[model samples]
Target: MKKTNILKNGALGALVLSVTFGCASTQQEEPAAAPAAKKDTACQAELAAAEAARKKAASVGGEWRDTGKILKSAKKALAAGDVAECIKLANKARRQGEMGYAQALEQRDNDVNSYTVERGDNLWNISGKDSIYGDPYQWPLIYKANRSQIKDADLIYPGQDLSIDRAVTSAAVNAAVQHAKTRGAWALGVVEESDKAYLAR
Candidate 1:
């Protein structure tokens, strides 16, 4: 009778131990899965943000090579399950893309040619110079551009600053020349003279 009682107690203890270990194993697995899922979500969010920034930069003619490399590295880190490293690299790529876009905008606006004034630089000589209009007749165009600085069309001093407008078409040039000829003839009291006689001088 005693042996029977001992056997029953030993069986009950074994059953309780098995149940407790099973519950512990299940709890441990649940915690591990939850953390992994959370990590995946974080990584995906970072990757999406980085991609958006890169596309915006590209649309503005930004340099994307370095950003592209950083993004690739981020993807590699993500695949390796290095969620922290992946997020860091992705953020870095995003900043690079933004900077590249800004630089592109600045360069676009800075695409202009500039020149400084020098001694012996009159409107006529400045326009005729090879670096400028390459035609002395284009002086009227220069005068029209610098109207605020030059009050007299006949006079321009050396060492003065001038802005050149290269958008002068041939038609505009001819019109300017005709206007100058008419004004000059009118000033000399020769409005009745032939156009050839007035322009010959």
Candidate 2:
């Protein structure tokens, strides 16, 4: 009878040990799985955000090379199980995209003038007219403004619309005036000391 009791006790202890170990194993697996799931979810969210930003930037004609590179790096980090690095790269890409969109908006807003080309209107004549910048040498401004329509600076069709961003014209004129002054055009009678005196007559 004593031998039977000893065998029963030993069997009971073995069964209890197995059950405890099984529960412990299950607990460890659950925690591990939870973290992996969380990491996956985070990576997916970051990727989605990055893609959205890239699209927004592209819509505004933003430079996508750098942003694209960063996004690709983010994807690589995610694939490598570096969730933190992935998120960092994704955020950087998003900011770059936003900055590009903002720059586009600023440029668009600064484009304040639009004009239609008329017959016999070359870029030089149009740019030198009193209503325009009044400087024949500023023809490049008109060419650049109408780059989409005017492939060559020397060619422009009548009735073609063109953008005339005054900001660019003003900057060019200022730079020219500075250069003329530096070259002593004022003393040589090539240009006037004041920009008003140098206006096309």
TM-score against native, each model: 0.51, 0.58
* Candidate 1 runs further than 4 Å off: 110-201
TM-score of candidate 1 to 2 decimals: 0.51
Cα lDDT computed for each candidate against the true fold: 0.70, 0.70
RMSD of each: 15.6, 12.3
lDDT of 2 by residue, 1-201 (tens): 999999999999999999999999998888878877898788889778888877786765554579999999999998999899998999888888888878756765654477788998886687677556556666656655565666545567899988875554334555544533443332322223343333321
| TM-score top scorer | 2
- Residue-level lDDT of model 1, residues 1-201, one tens digit each, is 999999999999999999999999998889888877898788888888888888776765564778888889999998999989998998898888788778756654563333456775666677677666556766766767776776655556666777776544446666556654555432222233333342333
lDDT measured at residue 165 in model 2 versus the true structure, 0 to 100:
59
Error (Å) of candidate 2 at residue 11 is 2.3
Task: Please give the RMSD of candidate 2 to the true structure.
Answer: 12.3
Model 2 residue runs over 4 Å out of place are 115-154, 157-161, 164-201
